[model samples]
Target: MVQTTPLVDRFGRVATDLRVSLTDRCNLRCSYCMPAEGLAWLPDERVLSDDEVVRLIGIGVSRLGIREVRFTGGEPLVRRGLSGIVARTRALDPGLELSLTTNGLGLVRLAGPLAEAGLDRVNVSLDSIRPETFHRITRRDRLHDVLEGLQAAADAGLGPIKVNAVLLRDVNDDQAAELLAWAVERGYELRFIEQMPLDAQHGWTRESMVTAEETLERLEKEFVLAPAAEPRGSAPAELFTVDGGPATVGVIASVTRPFCGDCDRVRLTADGQVRNCLFAREESDLRAALRSGVPDAEIARRWVSAMAGKRAGHGIDDPTFLQPDRPMSAIGG
Candidate 1:
């Protein structure tokens, strides 16, 4: 029997996509993701087991109107039973987009099984192609491994592989055009994201970040980019391409051009708390209720109420911005 779910704070927008964070722990101490002191990694017992995650996703798909599920992590590939999890998610026949986002450090080994197990697409977080600058940004030296992993994903037939580049002033910002052109040559959809309020340890300066407008102006100087047919809601990206190419380039202006309105995403941490916003100070715990054996109907009810009660948009753009208590990794970014 097919289960039914009630949609929540999704507003008029259907809640179709679910981003599931497998763990808050990641190997790369990238300046943007965590504190210099590091996250207080969740105890193994506290984390939702693989089985637990699958069950919640089943409920989400069957009831919450979710048709897409993306497995994310501090680095999703780091999880041992990852392929098994992907298999279960695929088994649901959710008729959804099943995708994965990663640092690509470990993608070489994991991409094949994940692809075979029904991962539809993969997005790699690559800030710079330069080995030295890459090391400077991520504090890791696995650029060659990452490149090979991207290629491995393609070879595995995980088509439409994407690269996500975060534009940091004096960092990878200068390479925005270069990266987009490179992605175009290879038929990859490249996305440039403006860095937002991440952990204080990352040393984010509003000054060091580039806005979507700045990126567009710079790119339009050479390439003729017309707007996309339909703008995806609250997504920070200003998507375009090199005139007649199949590949597209996207710019997410979350920091400088906040897309609070029309935002339709709710985040579930690896520990199973639902966050209404990346900048939110509050979250609702569904894991506890599930463990209490509450029926799926009740869970769906809570999901809707929570969704409706959620502020229309995350107030991240408030002049007096308070950083989310949790870091980006914990939030599944």
Candidate 2:
């Protein structure tokens, strides 16, 4: 049954999407994402099992009025038997719009299988078009593999394929136009994201930050851009199409242009914690309850209770704003 009363928060924003972290482990060490070393991985036992994850997602869909489910990870493809998880989640609600955000390293091999299983679409992290730049940003030489994976995903019919590029000043910022052209040429929607303060190293400063306005100024110099019709609800990206062309670009200006007012995304960590906002300081431990064999209805009620305390905004701009203890990888972004 569709939930009559959705997960509405203090601000009256009803969450229709849930981003679930499949694992807190990843293969790449992006400079902006995590440190080069000295990182500890989550114990295997701490992560949610496929059955547990599916059950939680089902409750969100059937009782909490969640219409879309997005699987994220340090890199979701790293988890074994991922297609099984995807198939199980899809089975819960035939109408659930399921998607994933991946670094694209393993999609070359798993794209077709995952598509066949029931994945609706994919968002690939492609920071740069230049191989050396890609390597420099991600600290990996898997650019070739990622490129091949994009083609494989397209061939497998996993679209509309989106390329998520986190723009950093003097780093990959100069290549913004080139990256968009490359993605447009390949039929991918390229979205340039402003670097936020979610880095595990906590080294994010406004000086190194690349704002959304700067990104648009850079892109508009290369292509004609007019605001495309936005869909109803809280979508992070503001989309634009190239003049006289079908290809488009989007900007996620979370810092400069906050979207928290319309924000409707809630998150579940791989360890079974529920987060109302990505930058929330507080989290509720649902894993403990699940492991204790608590009833599913009670678990669902706990989810609603957790989100009921959703904050007004992430407060990234506040003078006293502090980065959350969990990094984006651990938080399921």
Candidate 3:
């Protein structure tokens, strides 16, 4: 028999949003995400097969009440089978909301095919518009490629495309307002995310990370922002009207101003490990069960049990907090 229980934790937050990491390999080595050389990539056998990914997503939608599925990656576009994966997941449920979080490098070629295969939207990671600053932050000089990808995605009918940006102190922090202006002019929704302790280098410091207050203060100098009238709900980014109208910007202050109280997300790493929290030190191994020929219902039960132990918060404010071993790229962010 199939399980119908929603993926809920002790905090009573039902996890309807699922973030699935397609692979642990990326094309760029952003200073904040990983080193220039990059970390070791997961072996082919360890990562979930395209079929395995679809099966798990099927269970999440048909049995576990998943409403939205967002495909993430070290860079999701690098996955050879991304379009097929999206197509298969869409076949599971026509109503299932499917999206992707990518670096926007591959979208120039794949965006049309992905949208044809049923991808509803995309969130591209773009830190700076200037080529020099972009290279400094991402260790790459592909800002022009990313810009082309954005336009390609727009031409493919991906409306309200979102750009996820992270500001580094003395790096690209001063470009917050400038990036926002660029996004506004192009009709893309820009979200500024506060740097978290998820870097592979483990160099993230609370003192060095920019805060939401500072981001808002910076934006206010160039644009008038009032809180968007819409309720935040389970979404992480808090939206603000850019100039008191339809145009808006978002700030995902994951570190300083966490929204864990209403978090409704569950993450699956590329290796098929279920992460209940982004900073979780432990993971429930779903790949082992799938490989061992366990029934789908049993796998669903294991997922439920794993989520039940989720902590009230990420505990970044705790005196003895420790960052997880896996970095943001490996953790599917």
Candidate 4:
């Protein structure tokens, strides 16, 4: 059932990357992501098991031409048997590029296991370098723990670890320089992502967002950065580096500079929905197909069809653009 045709959307953008959410549970409650309380966790039966996740990924690789897989969640590290899932998925396609995005709160205990399980790299969510600011943003006092987890990840040979920092105007925005210095000193790549309207509380506003241009302007003050000389490829970030420094930083301008034209990524939520875009208004249910004992080819067909129906773009900038009902955490970011 391996189709010769690639998974190309109507716009002709081919899909090569898949993001799978392991769970919707998180330890820390980031203000920009989730509310302080009142999150209803999905039932156990609704969540996909590790075997199911690995099977879907195998189908994606063997039939849909997917080459890279990233595990995301409320925090991927929160899921039990995560290392085993990584190992199984990697075993499916030895050459597949496998990665994970986590809050790093649990990475201190899981990094080594994950690396041994064949994880390639990681992107950890770290908003601020100051403990007070970190607590204020994440509502957790685990800044020291996160730093330790990052070190553990590095020690486990997770090279080129990226730190994802979401910038909110006047909220931890002034610490961009300090955060960069901290990451550079530790040999970690830092990336600033503009705040999107993905919070569960729907508190996001255009005025509250700190644009990528603004971030670069602030970063340029503390470091001599030049844009990367090579093509950006399909990566969401616009990369830059210090004049002669070892560390590099990236800015993801999802709001300002949409990468929808070249978006190669599709997301599978923990409950089994296939989302063409992060801000998609609709999702195709893959779990139903999986649970119905459908053939792997049929499951792949659902994926292919979903990609075909992908809109020209997410339409985030459109006048009628509506925020998704699913928050960033539930959506696997």
Candidate 3 residue 174 C-alpha distance from true site, Å: 0.9
Instruction: Answer with 1 or 2, whichever has the higher lDDT.
Output: 2
lDDT of 1 by residue, 1-333 (tens): 656654655456556667899988887777776655567888988788898899888888887877878888878888889999999989987476799989887778888999889999998999888898888888878889989999989888887888998877777777777877778877777888888776646466677668888888878876888777765765657777567555678888887767767666677789988776778778888888888898878877777676666666555656776787777887786
Query: Which candidate wins on lDDT?
Result: 3
10 residues in a row with least lDDT, candidate 4: 239-248
What's model 4's TM-score? Answer: 0.98
C-alpha lDDT of candidate 3 relative to the true structure: 0.94
Model 2 lDDT-worst window of ten: 1-10
What is the clash count of model 3?
Answer: 0
> What tens digits encode model 2's per-residue C-alpha lDDT throughout 1-333?
344457889778899999999998889999998998736889989999988898888888888889999999989999888999999988888899999999999998999999988999999998997989988988889999999999999999999999999987888889889888888888899998888888899999987799899999999888999788657358899888788567778999888888999988999999999999999999999999998999877888898889999989989889999999988889888
Clashing pairs in 2: none
- lDDT per model vs. reference: 0.79, 0.89, 0.94, 0.89
- After superposition of all CA atoms, the RMSD between model 2 and the true structure is 1.3
Global Cα RMSD, each model: 2.0, 1.3, 0.9, 1.2
Better of 1 and 2 by TM-score: 2
Total clashing pairs for each candidate? 6, 0, 0, 0
For candidate 1, give the lDDT: 0.79
Tens digits of lDDT, candidate 4, 251-293: 9999999888889898999999999899998999999999999
